[model samples]
Target: LHCGTGKVSYVGGNSKSPALFISLLKRLKATYRRAKTITLIVDNYIIHKSRETERWLKENPKFRVIYQPVYSPRVNHVERLWQALHDTITRNHQCRS
Candidate 1:
């Protein structure tokens, strides 16, 4: 999500993996082609620290990832957005899959 413009860029898959995370980064890079640097505020998910991810970051100098302090969800705005989404859409629904 873009903190300045509130624009969100996302990718969905069956699971979160280093490849998936790199895919998201590639999308962001394509989305902001002229940006000198794209800053991402992320949680300390294992994928974010995976060796593959680290190598990818080294290759992609334009992307920067800043991990939020552990256990501090309130510092991440995306968490709040997700909480609201769950509350409104999935907290108590009759959609039985």
Candidate 2:
């Protein structure tokens, strides 16, 4: 999510992997091409710190990742948004997909 414009950039996949996370970062970089830097607030998910991701980050110096406390979801606004999305759209729904 963009802090200034409230615009969200997201992509879904079967599972979380360093490749997937890197793809998301690429998408974000493309989305905000004009920005000098992109800072991501992320949890300590293994993929975020994986070798592949670290390699990519090393090549892309403009991107920064800040890890929040391991168990503190309240400090992340995106977590709250995700919770609301689950409550409204996914919880007890009958999609069966």
lDDT per residue as tens, model 1, 3-50: 889887888777799999989988999999999999988889898889
Estimate the lDDT of model 1: 0.86
Model 1 compared with the native: what TM-score?
Answer: 0.84
Please provide TM-scores, in order, for all candidate models, with all chains considered together. 0.84, 0.87
Residue-level lDDT tens digits of model 2 in 2-52: 888988788777778998999999999888899898999998989999999
Would you list the clashing residue pairs of candidate 1?
none
**Ten-residue stretch with the least lDDT total in model 2:** 69-78
Clashes of 2: 0
Quantify all predictions' global Cα lDDT against the true fold: 0.86, 0.87
The segments of candidate 2 whose C-alpha lies over 4 angstroms from its true place after superposition are: 93-97
- The alpha-carbon lDDT assigned to residue 75 of candidate 1 equals 83
Q: TM-score winner among the candidates? A: 2
Lowest summed lDDT window (length 10), candidate 1: 69-78
